[model samples]
Target: MAGIAILLDLWRKNQSFNAGLYSARTYQSTQFFSASAAATAATFAAGSSFASRALFGSQVAYSDAGAALPEDYISNIQSASERVFKNHALQYSTKQYDVQLKPLFSAFELRTFALTSLRSFLMYYLPLLEPRVNMEDDDDSLEDNQEDRHVDLVVPFKKSVIQIIRESTVVTTRRILERIAVHYVSQRMAWKILKDVPQSAARKAGRQMPTLVYIYCVSRTTFRGHMLGVAASWIVQVGIDLYRFFTSGFKTLQEDDDEKQVGVLAQRVSVAAVRCISSLIFASIGAGIGATLIRPSRGQWIGCAVGDLAGPVIVAVIADKYFHVTL
Candidate 1:
């Protein structure tokens, strides 16, 4: 009975302790709800006020880059418009842009004009002053006979001589032009190109691109184009020499009837062949010397002419002395 009484007393104490803890927790929760409600009410009151409304409305005000032009932009546009108006006024106004020019003629000019007018007048009128010549009964016959003689005697010789002259003239002109191009282009430019063109291909592709271009212009070598042109010119000279020799020799043979005397045709062909080669060599030497001493194109032409004239004499002399042949 005494142990049961002590147990009952301990149970009552535990129950009383639990009730006090529950009351304390409920009081804390009530205080927290009151404080939160007061804070919420204060926030609502502030939000409804004029200053808060103004602040909130001002936060996201209307704006864009196109809404207003910059001060500098407006000023620049105004300035440009003024400049255009000023330029236009200056350009079109008679007071600003009026210009006049009058030609002044000298005494010499007037005399020249008068002389030209007189000459033109004379040319236009003077031809009608002459009376027409009367035709004879045998005039047609005489004209026909003259035409026939011209066709037979003059035409063939003239045609042959003219053809030879034309060929020589064309060849000579081509050579002169080639020499001039070489002197102007190669000597003036090729050496500089050689210096600038780099040996390394990698660098050529990079910094020295113009050097590569120059090297290409050089025919992939040192003034190779000029050398090739000279060689081509020499070959052309040989062909020209052959034509001149054959044509002149044939004409001479026909005039003198010397074919029978010269014996073998082979010897004549050999002599002519040797003559052309020897002449070309002599011409090259002479051109080199003349070019070194004088203006390149003029010197080349002069030297070529001298060598050309002397070449035949040299051949003739050689034939007379060494070969005992008159070629």
Candidate 2:
């Protein structure tokens, strides 16, 4: 019943978001037409002697005002075009920054890294992560210490099974939620970028319905290079992590903090490197699997997207079980 209710709620939210998007598009169309009409009128009045005189007292007065007719018309169009282009360029830059960050998509990215890095080294091994919120430090500590979160059973075997199921469900749901949010925000950012004026970061990044990314990865080849790229990226990230693990300065953990918080340049670089590498590997794997199942290009794209998202979590889990070392 709970799952059904959540599904129904998500469906409703999706419909609402689609409707809002349609309305926004309609509004922008209206604005564009109006602006076009106004520009046309201004240009006509400025260039034609009769229109200029009729509109602004007299041709003599217009010329006295020092407004060159052709220059004004040309400059107006140029300015409008430049404004539109500049706004779009800014949004493009933001998107590029986002791609560099990888699995740390939006707000959850950093916290995800921190949790994965911290928990991997702890003596008491907890594989699942709790969601971060803006609560007090003491509240966070209390929550962290409660190891039986989401699953509690007396028998070790039964408890482990239940825990794994519960954790997997939670992890999967969170990933979906984050992906949905990122997808929508990205669409909104695209629209915001194309405007004559710049949009606020909050306006572009805030709550929105899930929408497709207007842009996508360019996978032009069916060669095995995609998979090779994935492996290469992972290897590079592992190398960087090892380098950072050895060179980065030690930072003391906060009194209430559950994990060691390192603040060295090497650590930051390694985290970013690892994220990018994982993203590439997953994308390649996804593309290959998808191609086998469907159209090569479409399948590749779908696979790549899924891989990019799931890759980080997979890496984190592998590290937790095998490496069992802290950064």
Q: Whose TM-score is greatest here? A: 1
* Candidate 1 residue-wise lDDT, 1-327, digit = tens: 223223433543465455566654443443333333334333443445456445543221211122233556545555665676677788887532211211222212556455544554454345445554445559887787567444243454455554444444444544454445445664534343323212222233344345336334322332322343334445555555567566767777574445542443446555555665556555555544443345544554455556655766788898899988775
Candidate 2 lDDT over residue span 178-249, tens digit each: 455455656554333222111121122233412221112122131222433344444444555555545532
TM-score between model 1 and native: 0.27
Q: Which regions in candidate 1 have their CA more than 4 angstroms from the true location?
A: 1-263
Error of 1 at 5 (Å): 84
| Alpha-carbon runs more than 4 Å astray in model 2 | 1-263
Please provide TM-scores, in order, for all candidate models, with all chains considered together.
Answer: 0.27, 0.24
